[model samples]
Every structure is written in C-alpha cells, then in structure tokens.
Target chain A: MSIQIIKQGMADSIQDNGRYGYQHLGINPNGVMDPIAATAANLLVGNDLNDAVLEMHFPASVILFKQQSLIAICGADLLAMINDVFVPVNTPIIIEKNCVLHFKKPLSGARTYLAVKGGFDLQPWLGSYSTNTKAVAGGFEGRNLKKHDEIRFRAAVQKYDAVLNGKDCEILQWKASVKNFYAAGNILRITTGSEYDWLNEDAKKLLLSSSFTISNQSDRMGYRMKGDNLAIENKQQLISTAVTKGTLQLLPDGQFIILMADHQTTGGYPKIAHVISADIPTLAQLNAGEKIQFNIIGQQEAEGILFDQQQQLQQLQNACSFPLLKFKQQYAIN
Target chain B: MKSPLPYHILPLGDHALTIELGNSIDASVNQNCIAVFHQLKQAGLAFVKDIIPAYASVTVVYDVTAIRKEKPSAYLFMKEKLEILLAGMDLDQPVSHRKIEIPVCYDLSLGIDLQEMSQEKNMSIEEIIQMHTNKSYRVFMIGFLPGFAYMGSVDEKIITARRIQPRTNVAAGSVGIAGEQTGIYPLDSPGGWNIIGQTPLKLFDAKRENPVLLEAGDMVSFTAIDINEFHIIKGSI
Candidate 1:
C-alpha cells in the first residue's frame, strides 16, 4: 500500500543514517539532521536503525493513507492530527485506511520524523536513501517532496495488524525520551579544533562567555552565528583542508558558522572548534533566532558523553524489540 | 627519492581524524597525502567509512559504533592503528597518474568575466586564453561541490583573485580561475571566481558509475575550441 501527499509543506524528504564513502569526490553526506529521534521512530516501528524515514520540517505535509499501517512520529511536536484527532509524539500508532494526517501550529523543535513499518520501499542511491538535494541525487527523485507525490511502503499486514491489535488507532505505552541527550540552557558542548590555538586569549574568552544568536541565513549546510567578533592572533590564510559536519569555522569577518549535515567536504576557513556528537541533535532542533552558548569540554569528555548516548540508544532498541518479538510469537499461526 | 615528510595527526572530534601533512600547498605534499589515503583505504579497516584528501591533509571519517564494539575507545584505536601504519609508510613510492583534456569554448559571450580579467591582467583576451590552455595543472583536491575538481598552480601571470561581488548563479561546466587555482563548476551555484569559458561535457552525472569527472592527484589541461565545435560536442553528448 502507499501514502499519497495531499499538500507538501515547507520541506520534507526521505532520509536514513547518511550517505558515506563519497566525500573524497566532494559529495556531502546528507541525511536526517537528528539521528536520535529518527532512530527512535524507526525502533518503534520494528525497523532497522538505518531504515529510511520521512524527515519533515515545520509546517510539514498532509498525507492520506491508502491502507492501514503502523507508524511512529518522533522529534518536534508539530501538533500532528489524524482525521482531526490529535496524536502524541515519540510513540507508535496505527492509522486506518483513507484517513488524512496533517500538522497544525509550530511547537517545539524544527524537525519531525515519521517512520513506517518495514521502512519505505524507496530506491537507495549510493547505498543510502538520504537525499542530497544539492547534487540532485539520492532519495525520492533527488528533491523535496511535492504535492501529489505518492510513497509506497514495504507493507507487512500481518506484522502491523499484530502491533495494532485490530484497533483503528492505537498508541504504545512506552515512549523514547530525548531529554537526556539535550543540554540544559541550550548550551552546546564543543572541543577545541586543530586551529583552536590561532585564537587569542581575549577571543577565546569572548567565545566561551558570550551568547551567539543563530542568524536566519542558516540552513542545513551551516548555521551562521552573530556574536562578539573573535580575533585571531595571525592574519595568515588557512590552507584549504578537509572539514566535516559540526566543524565550527571562523569566517574572515570574525563571525562563526557551524557546519551541518549537508556541509561541504572541505573548507578554507580556520576551524576553531567542533560540537560534540551527543549534542548535535539538540543543535539540529534549534530554530533560527535562538541563542546558544558554547561550553568547551575536553576531547575525552566529549567521547565519554558520546559513548553514553550510544549505550542509551542501544538500550532503547532492546526495549522496543522485546515487545515486538513477544507479539509476533503470540500472533503467528503455525 | 626525497625523505619522508613530517606530519601531525589531529582529532576532528570523536569519529574523524585529520592528518595534516604541512602548512604549504605543494604538489609533493599533496602526493604524500594521496598516498596515505590509498594506504588507509587498502587497509580495509572496518571502522573507517570515508577518506577525504585535500591540499595538505587527509580527513578520515570512521564509524564510532563499529569501532567501539571491538575496542574500548574508538579514537584511541584509530590513533594506534594509524601510528603503526605510518611507521613503515614510504612517501617516495611511485604511483600512476592520469591526464585528462577538457575542451573549453572561450567565446566572449560565454566568458562573463573574461574582459574584466583581461583588463586587470593587462593582457589581450587571446593571450589570456593561451596562458590558461598552455599549462597542465595538477588536481590538488575535489571539493566545494560535487565533481568540482580544484586544479592548481595556474600560470603566475594569469593568476587573479576572486571577484569582490560574486555572481548569483554560475552555470554548470563554467570554467573559472581564482588566485593560483582553476576549476570548473559541476553544478549551477553562487560563485566569485573569474569565469573565462564554459565546457560542453557534463562534469558531474549522478547516474554514471563514477559521478565525478576528475579526482585528486590527476593532471588536467584545457583545449580551446570555437563556439560551433562546442555546440557539436554538446549535441553529441
């Protein structure tokens, strides 16, 4: 069965973990901006961690389900409604056939992920379903979802029915909480980069103490920040080098830019710092005009936080899968 | 053969590592960077996901989940493994090279910044075209966009800085030069380089087995052509 798009909102595309092994050719690893939420949604639907999901930005789309399916909506509280009835986030639910799903007013985060059972039956480009819009490749026709675009699912009626328990709409009891991954006061933890020594002492002080406002010019490529100017000790040009997602670059004008999922493979600006992996999801959810402070942490500390986050995700995966295994054992007819 | 060059391995967060070869952008240093990239890929490390080679460094991105499963720490495992690999590394080893000829049409209508560049350099348009086509430049890196190969060390006379006001849209296959580097735009995007000509060939086709026309460590030379020839080549493709 398939879902038909009635109205496409701001920007929505199919994404998985990310596209890899092509960075040397200048290809960006475009993928879901928030991995934790996306993975949580996938786990709720009994799909693999890297299974493709619909990453919808605020003011997202309206879809009509052609057949009954099990689904989960994670991340941003977009006020999702199924046939005029409100639904909750971070939980699995079943949608009856011919029911319309739409989003209302903007709520908390900037992105929301919708995962279906068995994942989407979309073709994978470069070994990934993640869309790279810049290259006009990958995902569904290499672009944002447009009105009337139909997406087919790898439907498993028996599996979804067992999860649904023959109900038209059912919400699971257990929900995956993303609160532990986010930092208090919107402070992002970062580690000094290779060129961190280039900044003067005063500049370093300003960077840590001052709060930076995210400019409207920010996008999936980078988040342009406005704050006190950071001065470098030397005026020499940095030889262009390899850069990756989360690299905080200092522009010529003394402004800051945090590279995001769709960032270029290499850059010429001096990388002053890099945000830790654990807090990347929080940063991804932050909207423009939001203020963020940087907290400098040692590399070892950053690694420790990342390890803990991964371990928590593994525990959640195990928790979600156990119930599904029991449901399958009871429902399957020999 | 020259002795092995000194390098510093720096961490680029928990999952990636940057190998800085040197401060300058020399051909030899870039070759060494490429050599290390090949060696690392040949190692077939289960943790390593991608390797990017630039002007003077190679950034290796790894899967932390996979690495952490085998070792207590992913970063430490990468550092130790790389140290052992580099201990026996030979920087002077001979490697194969590929030379590619790109056909360009330098018609004044197609070259938006040709006249400005000519005036700034105090050279005639024909002379500028001749200088651009004479040298076989080396590909230092491929970045900024997909299939955009950064070829370098353009003739000193023709070298010019980027435009103060970048154009809103630079068409795909447009050849441009900025500072000591020359490159062709694989996609239409905002750019500030001095556009001198356009190529009919598709520099990047995602449908192809190899999407990029050029890669790091390759040699590229331009062949000037007339508008009619450009149209002929464009139609044939």
Candidate 2:
C-alpha cells in the first residue's frame, strides 16, 4: 500500500506545479525545480500534471515497494536500479512487491522526480502538495522524506502478474522525449529584467558575454553565481518588490543570485536579468560549480518556447492516456 | 477612474509581468499598485495565478499555458488587457485599510540590539521605545519570509540603518528597524534589521483561519507592554 524509504537522500520532498496565490501573504511558491521532468513523470504514470511527485537529488533515496505498483522515474539520470538490475528513466515500470529501488550514480541532471500511478494519498496544505520547508506545513508531513518513511499511494495496489511474469520488474516501451527541452547545451535563455538598464555598459556587456559558475551555496531557494563583478551605474537603494523564480538579482557585492522554486516572495536587490521561463528546467538541472552562459531573447520568443513545451506535454499526456487506461483496466489498477 | 502616477508594465519573465508605479516607496505609488492588484483579483482572470503587491509595484504571475489557449501571445494579450484596466482605474482615490494594534515587549533580553541602538542614537532606551510606539506604520509590503510585514517611515529620531553585519538568526516575533523601514520576523530567519522589541502573538500560524497576520496596505500600530503581559498574551494565543 505504501513505498518505504530504505535510505533517504538530501532534501527529498514531495512537489508538484507549486503553491500559488499566496505570495501576498509572504509565502513563497515552493515546487519542483524542474517542471518538465516532474510533469513528464506524472504523465508517464497516468497522473495529473499537478499530482505530487517525489523530488530527489544525488545520493538519492533507496526505496522498497511494499506492494506492486506502476511508477515512472524522470529527470536526472541517476542510474536507477531495481533488485540489482538497471532501469531506464522516462518510461513506466511495474515493480513487484518488496523490490528494492536505488540509484547507482549521478549521470546527468541534479534532481529526479518519481511519480506513482494515482499520485500520493497525503493531504495538501494551502491548496498544494509542494513542500514548504520554511513554514513546515505542506507535503508529506511538511518535511523532507526521512529514513524508513512510508508514503502511501492514492490507488490500491494491483497485481501485475501478467506484466511481471514472476519477474521483479518490467519496463514499458514508451518514453517521453525530454532531451530537446534541455538542448540549449548549458546556455540558458534570458529576458531583460526591469532593472536591466541599471547596470553599467561594461557590466551589461559582461552579462551576455562571460560565463558564470553556479556557486556551492546554490540551493532550491536561489543559485548564487560567481563571475565578473557587475555593478550598477548609480549606486542607490531599490525598494523591495515582487520577484519570481528565474529572477537574476545583482547582490551588493557584484555577484548575483538566480531565484528558484523556493525564492522569497519579494526582494530589494537590483534585478539585472531574468532567465526565461522556458529555460528554468534546464537551469534547475545544472549542478553546483557548473558553468552556465546566458543568451538574451525577446519576450515573445521566450513565451513561444514555453507554449511549445506545454503543447508537447499535452501531446504526451494525450498519447499515454489510452494505453495507460487499457493497461489499468486489464489489471484492475486504479 | 485613472492613475495619476505614470506606470509601465514590463515582463518579469515569460510567465510573469510587473507593473512599475514608481521608483521609491511613496504611499500614493504603492496605493496605485494595490489598486491595480485589487482590480485584477476582482476580475478573476483564469490565466492569472497570483497577484503580488510590493512597495511600488505589483507583479502578476500568469499561467502561460492557460493564456496561450485563448491568445497567440501571452505578453501582448496581458499587456493590452492590463493597459486597458489601468487606464480605467482611479489610483488617486484612497482605498479602505485595516488597522491592527500589536502588543510588544521592549525588554532588553528579547531585544538584543536595544542597548547598541540606544548607544548609537544617543537617546535613552525609554525614548527609543516611545518613538517606535508613537506613530502608526504603513505596511508597504509583506515578504522576505512567510507572514513577515515590511512597514515603514519610522520616526527619524529612531530611524537606524541596517546593521553592518546581519545576525545569522533572528527569532520569530522579534521586531526590528532598518533605515526608514521596520518589520517583524514571522519565522526564524537570518536578517539585518536592528531589533528593539518582541511580540508574543504569532505572526503566522499554519492552523489559523488566516495564516498571515499582516498584509501590504495594512496600518500597524505597536503598543508597548510589560514582560509579564507579553507572556500572558503569548500563552493565551
């Protein structure tokens, strides 16, 4: 009925699209850093795009399914394994009861999302299942997944005798195409921030030309970038204002921070540039110390990329529905 | 109904747009921002996910997928709609406000920076406390942390700049001042404001009907209380 965590990873928590409509109350929208992978994972499992999924990082969690279930692992290629056998990501897998799941090594991205058949049975706080660690009030008891934590599935366990064939696990043939979304090759697209003109000519030139390394201090809240000092032409105070994810704020010391899923609702720093929303998934996948370059694009182009991504996701969902429904009905799975 | 102050809408990212009313924290400018926020919220546009009001701007976080379903370009669609809405809004007109009175204990133990502030301002501790409690502060924004309220224009006599080095952790309910602004930390977080008092009432409670205690455009007045009253109020809440 539930999946027990044999071992816990760093900051493993449940996340969805995000907690929204509460920024006015100073509540930050804490959600999955990489929406593409999270959505694809949910789509693969025949779950709603907003269904809660387990977000795990390197040294990922080791889990043992207490019951047979259909699940899909997406995003970071952490070398997923079940019962000592290798498994592929971006595809659904039916696992037998008591089969152990773990990651062997970090292969590609920084975060991996695992989605179950009918989503988690846990209750949502404030209209969302995403974990708000600061408030400690949402997602799986409002905290990171601990060792031995058993999260129940929303759907009842169904016997996958036909698919498993007495085997430990079986992988499906279909997989979501996720490569093109991260095809920017470490270059994240950006749009002009409101305070973009605040930067001096040299700083503005350096922003688009030079590369910045994601500092070790980077996390879900914000990614601190280390690069050439970017200074504003006029050294004056900026009033606190609303900031969203991908907001590249120039700190007082020339270095800047790119706010992420857990960013503060409002900030006072100067926003030099904003990473286009379409590239947030790609930016979220970059590991600490990875060098990332920025390319500024028009607002329309950025929105076009975002619209295309959403359309692709919708197409994937549409393609998987019939097959998933047939398979679920065959096995009496919810 | 029209906005007297000049305002412009800029795309924050592909998914969000910000309406900049002014550069500084003028009350009229913020009022205009709030006016726009209220109108948008009232419209209940399905594409708009959240509307956040800050000191002098309002940020509208929209759903690109939702917007694209109705229009070819999200930015253009949103910009035109927002422009039309703003054109008909009378930002000069005053909006109703909620006044909230908060009790604060100015004891030194709870206020770690009181002694330092007293020395820096060359004023008696009582005078500093008097200045803080004397005037009603306007909450220009709610941010930095959940339920944290940024209120402003403290008495010039007690106005202090942020500390050279911010403390690693400031306890919840600790009231602090930074330059012309004063705020209370609703959660335990690192901050740079100069602490002067503590409040027992929980600024934020997940179980409460309204989790956030204060919001932008709120009028907050602090009433000084003894240490015992602080405990009694704390225990009661």
Candidate 3:
C-alpha cells in the first residue's frame, strides 16, 4: 500500500531520529527539528517513534491511502483539513482510499509532521532519511519534495484495525497537543557557556535582561536573532573546536546563533550558552518573530531537570509499547 | 614544568564537562589536554563519552546523570588521575615521521586561488609551492571536515593570512594554507583558506573501516606531483 503526493508543500521531506556517531567526520546529524511532536504523531499511529515520516513546512497538503489507512497530523496546528472536515491535532483518524487530504497552512508553528501506521516507505539514506538542505544529502533525493512526488508505505504486522476494518471515518480520543500546555512566551533558561566568561559584562547583562525574537534568518542549521547585540570582552580568533547540537554561539559581529537539529559538528565561534536539552522541543516550535527572554541557570539544577525529562521519555516508551505489548499480554491470558 | 594550578572540572551540558586545566591558553594547556585524554581513557572511564582537546581547554563528554549519581567531584577525580598520568609521561615522546605522498597538481585552473594566494604571500607561484611542500608539519587536530587534518608549524616565510572572502566550495583533498597552518579538505566544503594546490587522493571514504587517513597528533609531509600523476592517482582511487 502507498500514498501519492498531489500538492507539494513549501518544503517537505522525510526525516527520522537522525544519524549519529559521524560528527568526528564533520557530518552534521540532521533530523526533525521538533523531535517531540514528531514522536507524538508517530506514537498516535502506533508506529516506531524513529520511523520515517513526511515533515511538511508551512502551507501544504497531500493525498493518501491505497487500502484505507490510519494517520495522525502533528506539530503545528496548521489548520489541517481531513476530507473537507477540519480535524483536531494529536488524535488518530482513519482515512479512506482516494481521499483528498489537505493541510491548508500552518498558523501557529513553522513545521508539522504526518505519521501513518507501518511508517512511510522511504528508503533510508546513509542510515537516515533526514533532509540536510545545506549538504544536499539525505531525505528524498537529498532535497525537498517536488511537485507530484509519489510516496509509498511499508507493510507491518499491525495495520490499524480501525482502517483494516474499513471504517468510513473514525477519530481517536483527544489529548491536548503539547503546545497548548506552554505559556505563549516564557523565559528560556540556559546554562552559561565557556564563552560566557569571554563576553563583556555589559553584553552578559544584555543576554540576561533583553528579549530576542527568532529572526526569519532561522533555518535547520542555525537560528539568527535581532536583539541587544551581545559582545565579547576578548576579540581573539578561537581555534576551531568540536561543538554539538544546542550550542548557542555568539558571532564576532555581535549576533547569536542558536544551533539546531542540523548544526555542524564543530565550530570556532565562542559559545555564549546552551539552551537546556528539555526545552529544545519548545525552541524548535518557535516561528519567525516569536519573542522570548533568556534566563541564566545553574548547570546542576538544569541536569536534574534534564534527568526528569529523560525519565518521562522512558515512560512514554513504556506507554507506547501497547502496540506490541498488548498482543503479548493477550497470549499470556489465553 | 610547574604542575598545573588545578583543573576545574565543570559540567558543560547534559553529556559533557569542561575541565579547565589553566585559565590561560598555552602549550602547557594543550599538553594537559593530551595528558587528561590518556588518563581518562586508560582508567577505562566507560561513563566518559569523549574528550575534545581545544586550545588550552578540553571538554569531556559523559553521562551527567551517571556522574551525578556517583557524586564524584569532577575536579578531584580528574585531577587525581591526571597527576598520576602526567608524572609518568615523558615530554620527549618519540615522534615518528611518515612521508605521505599527496599527489597535488599546482595548476591555477584547478587550484582556483593559486595566483591570488601567491600575490598575497608576495612570492612567485612556483616559490610558494616549493616552500609549502618542502616543510614537514605536525598534525595538531582532525576537524573542520572529515579526514581534514590540521597540520601546522609551517615555515614562517610563507605564513599568509586566510582570505577575507571564503570560497563557497573547495573540492575534497584540496591542499590549502591558512596562516601558518596547512590542511587538506577530506570533503567538499566552504572554507576561508587560500587554495594553492589540489590533492588527488580520497581523504575520506565511508566504506573504509578507518575512513580517515590522518588523526590528531600524527606527522605529515606532502609531496608535489605532476598533473598526469594526479589524474592517474585520482582515477585509480
């Protein structure tokens, strides 16, 4: 069974958990910018959270279903319409064959993810299907989806019974999309980076006190901003060194680069601070001109919070295992 | 040499620590990085993920949750281990030399910035090539690009600054000089280095078990080759 693309979005590509362990080779592990939402959508459809899915940017839609299918629309609210009926986010819906699935546009966030049972059948590239627009590798032909690109599907043990049973229209129970839980604008706490000491006292204060808006310059690689131009006390060339995802780099030109999912393996810029790992998902959802404040935090406190967040993910994994764990339990009961 | 004041093993992120051996950047700091690297790995610090040796500073990645559970002062644990390791290490470690023949074609058509680099260095194009190839260099680090080794301590005479304008794309294995340091591009990437020659060998290949030809702290020397020899090596690879 397969789904065909009718209306290609502004930018759409397949992405999974991302490729790792190759940073020493200078390769940036590019993947879904909003991993949390992507995983949520996959879980709703009872698919592996790391399974490949179509990541669509603002403004797009597609047609799906060969022998009926179950899918979930996630990430941005995006005013998604299912067969002329506007549907809510964070829920599973059974789609019929030849249904004209339309995602009118993203109103709140930048990108959205669509997950199907058994996952989209996109062949992996270099062990990942993530789209790295800069390196021009990975994803579909290592680029964005074009007009009328035909996407297929993989067969699996559990074809959503709701779809296989040939239900005309069925929507799953509702749970609020995670976005609804957060305050519109909250202070982002970050651990002071090694370069924090290098920043002039005035610049350091500005970093703490000032509000910065996510500029249109934001992309998968880095997020640019217009704010109180943070400065460094010492303006010497820093020899290139290894950096990682979430490294908040301050450029010599008095700008900040919030490293994202597709950030380079290493960098020479003096890193100002790192956005706490738990907040990275929220940071990814931010769209152009979304204003947010930065608050300095202690490393120990942040690590404690991060551990709690990890434990929560482990719980999520345990919870999602109903897709397979259900069968094991039934067999034991029999 | 005087023992380091003491390194503050502070957490960097969820999985890393910035062990500050000295506040100032110096050769001693780099040596300390090398020393800590040896000690941490020798101790079979499985929780210690990776160590990135920087200019005067080294950041070691580890599971913060694990470290916190252990409640070991990163300073006490690391410093204690380093003191023992440094005490045993000899400053005059035997340095091995390898004559790695890189087939480089010094043609301007392929090198792109050959003429512009020579003009900046205030030397004949031929003179620049000779000075660059004649010097043996120490591999300081492997970064910037895969298999791209940062070899340095070049002869001061040909120490030209990096181009103010970075080229959008420098082909893989391009030999370029940035200031006193020379490096090879293992992958096609944008760079600010002044390109003087192009190497024909494949510096990186994912298929190989050890994809990189050079690593940090290795010794390297490049030998010039004719365009015909370059094509032969290039095609054979």
Candidate 4:
C-alpha cells in the first residue's frame, strides 16, 4: 500500500503530464523531462498515460515496499536492483512486501521513471500532479522527494496479489519498445523559430554544423550550451514574448540556451530554433558535458514524426491490455 | 483616436502559436492583446490548452493530440482556425480593467537600496516616495517567477538601472524599480532591481482561488504608509 524512501536520489520528484493553462500567471508547466519514457513506464504498469510517476535523475533513490505491488522502470537504464537481484528496464515486475529497491551507477541516460500500478495517491495542483519547486506548489509538498518520505499507492493489495499469483516476484514477458523514441547519436531534430532569420549567415552556418557542449550551468530551466558565438545581423532588441519548452534562445553574448520543462513563461532573448516535441525526450536524456549537434528538420517532417510517435503510443496502450487480460484469466475467480 | 493595431500570427512550434501585437510597450496595444485573448478564450476552442498574454504578444498553446484527432495536420488546423478568428475579430474593443491599490512602507530599514538610489538620483527620500506613488502603473506581464507582475513605465526622474550585483534574496513584497519597470517581488528570490520599499500584501498565495493578485491587464497604484501601518496589515494577514 505504501513505499518508504530509504535514501533520496538526485532531484527525484513526482510528475504527471504537466500543469497547463497557468503560464499567463508565470507558472511553469513543471513535469517529467522525458514524457515518452514516463508514458512508457505508465503503460507497463497499467496506468493512464498522464498518471503521476517518480522521475529520478542519476544516483537515484533506495526504496522499501511496505506491501506487494506491481511496478515498472523506464527511461534510463539505471541498473535498479531488488535486494541483490538485478532488475531490467522497460518491463513490469511485481515486488513482494519488505523488498528493497535500489539504483546504482551511471546508466546510459540521465533520467529514470518509475510507475506504480494505479498511480500515486497525491492531490493535483491546478489540474496536474507535477511539482513546481520554484513556486513551492504542487506534487509532494512542492519539492523533491527526500529520505523517509512515504508514498502511498492507490491500488489495493488484493488487486496486486491477483496479478502476482502467489509469487514473491514476477517479471512480465513483455517489454516496451523504446529504441524508436530516441534519436541515433547526439543529433537533435529541430525546426526554425520565428527569429531564425535574424542570425547572420556565418552564425546560421555554425549553428547547423558546429557541435556544442552542454555547460555545467544547465538545469531544469534551460541547458546553457557552449559552442561558436552566434551573432545576429541586426542586433535589435526583441520584445519579450512567450517562450515554451524546447525554445532555443540566443543570449546577447552570443551563447545559446535550450529552454526545458521548467522554463519561464516569457523571455526577451531571440528564439532561433525549437527542438521538435518528438525529439525532446532524446534531448532530455543527455547529461551535462555531453556533446550534441542540431539537425534542422522541416515543419512537415517534424509533424509527421510526432504523429507517428503518438500512433505508436496508441499501439502500446492497446498491446498492454493483453497482459492485463491474461492476468485476469489466470487469477480471477469464475 | 488610436489607429488599428497590426498583428502577426506566428508559430512558436507545432503546438503553440503567438500573436504578435506590436514590438513596444503601449497601453493601446496591450489592451487590444488582452481583448483578443479574452475573445479567443470565450470562443472555447477545443484544442487550446493555455493562452498567455505578455507585453506585446498572446501565445496560444494547444493540445496537438486533440487537434490531430479532427484534422490531418495539427498546425495547419490551428493556424487556419486562428487566422479566421483574427480576420473577423474587432481589435478596437475595450477591455475591462481592474485597478488594484497596494500599501507600501517606505521606511529606511525596509528600503534596502533606498540610500544608494537616492544618492544616485540626487533626490530627497520624500521626493522619491512622491514620484513612485504619484503615478498608476500598468501590469505589462506576469513573468520571471510565479505571481511576479512586471508593471509600469516609472517616472523618468526616478528611473534607474538594475544593480550590478543582485541581492542574493530580496524579501517577498519588496517593491523594486529597474529601468522603466517597477514590480513587487512575490517570493524571496535573487534580484537586481533597486529596492525602494516593501509591501505587506501577500501578492501570491497558491491556496487562494486566484493565486496571483495582479495579472497582465491590471492597473496598480501604490499608497505610501508608515512602518506601524505595515506591521498592522502584516498581523491581520
């Protein structure tokens, strides 16, 4: 019925899809950095796409389950373990009571998502369970999960036991396909923003060809990138306007910043490009000091990729039902 | 008489569209922006998620998933619908304004940067206070942080630039002026504005139905008060 955090990991917090409609009030739509991975984890646990999940960065937490429950780990390959046994990612597993789950070492990606069956029993703020730490609102006390924090599950013990079928632990045969969601290598697909033409020819060329290193100053708000100085031809002051997640802004000093999940509602910098929604998860998984390149894609192509991804998610939702049906057939009484 | 406002509807991305009303801060332009924002919300577009109005633009964030269900292309559908709405829209419609009065204490202790600002501006403390409280300011936008309303074109005589070294944490409700803008800090955060006074009002309360006291289209006027009155208001809250 509940899980207790033995050791809080680095920047772990409960997040749903996001808190929408409040950007006008300067409220950021703080949520899971990688929505694709979060959705995949939820699907594995028989939860809705927008269900709240635990989003953890590297060097994540250790938890002890107080009751039997079904769970799924997705996103980064964090090398999670149950007691001494290794647990795999992208697959659903049933944990017995008193079992300890711990994550160790740096995996391939930066973030890991954990989804429990029936989602977390938490109140939503402004129609979302996403935590906005700056505002001190939403999620679990509006902050990152700390050691000794107890999270209660909405699922009943009897329901999870039915899925477990008297087994102490069980790993489902099926796994979520995540390879297609991420881009190959470090190239992030992007589309030209409204101010794309404001850059000089040399700066525009450098933007497309040069490789940029993610600076240590990067955070949930934005990724400060270090590369060639991209100068604008006009150097005119752009009026402050609405800036969304993935908007690539050019600072006055000619540096670049990619806005993220917790980006401000509006910004004054010139927006040169925007990372496609389909490729945001790939960008989110990249760690600081990691080198990445921008590959400009047409608007039509970006839209096509997004549509395909949504279709794949729909397929995943449909595919997950088979396992639920099998569990019911084997465990439910006639 | 005011001329008709010219606007451009540009795509922020696949999911969001921004209507650029003008490039500068003007009352008429902002009023038109607010009017259009209200109309769009009243239109009740099924795919629209969030509508954010700023100094010179109104960004409409829509749900691509919902938009795609009805049309073959999400962006095209949004663009077309928005364009149609804009074509038939009235840009001169008057928007209702809410005038809010905030009480501020300009005590020497509370105004952390008052001495520095007074020396820089070569003005007396009473003159500085008079200039700040005389004029009513317009809320251009609420940004930088939640409930932090960016308001005004402050009087030129009292206008000043941001501090070279920002304070590590400016106490919440501290009224500060930077450049032509003046705002009250809704939270204790790092800021560089020239602090002139402090208010007792809780500008932001998440528990309240409307978390932010001021929004993009409100009018704000400050009333100078003494330290004793500040304490009295603080205790009541």
DockQ top scorer: 2
Q: By summed lDDT, which 10 consecutive residues of candidate 4 chain A come out lowest?
A: A158-167
RMSD, one per candidate, in order: 1.8, 1.6, 4.3, 1.8
Q: On residues A74-158, what C-alpha lDDT tens digit does candidate 3 reach at each position?
A: 7888887767777767777767666667777667777788888788767665678787665456677668887677777786533
What are the TM-scores, per candidate, against the unseen true structure?
0.97, 0.97, 0.84, 0.97
The number of clashing residue pairs in each candidate reads 0, 0, 0, 0
Report the TM-score measured on chain A for model 2.
0.97
Candidate 3 docking band: acceptable
Each candidate's DockQ: 0.80, 0.85, 0.32, 0.79
lDDT of 4 by residue, A95-130 (tens): 888889888777788899999888899889999999
Local distance difference test scores for all models: 0.88, 0.90, 0.70, 0.88
* Residue A69 lDDT in candidate 3: 70
What is candidate 1's lDDT per residue for A1-334, written digit by digit as tens?
Answer: 7888899978899999899999999998989999999999999878899999999987899999888777899988999998878889988777888888889977888899999888888888889999989888888899999899998987655334655565556675667776787778889999999888999999999989999999999988999999999999978988888888899999988998999989999999989999998889999899999999999998777877888888999999898877766655765711
- By DockQ, the better pick of 1 and 4 is 1
State each candidate's chain A TM-score.
0.95, 0.97, 0.88, 0.96
Clash count, candidate 1: 0
In model 3, pairs of residues that clash are none
Candidate 4 global CA lDDT score: 0.88
Candidate 4 docking classification: medium
- What is the C-alpha lDDT profile of model 2 across B1-237, one tens digit per residue? 542558878888888888888888887777777777888889787688889999888898988878888898998898898888777776666589899999999999998899999998799999999999999999888888899998988998888989999999999999999988999999888889999999999999887878999988889999999999999999998
Worst 10 residues of 3 chain A by lDDT: A325-334
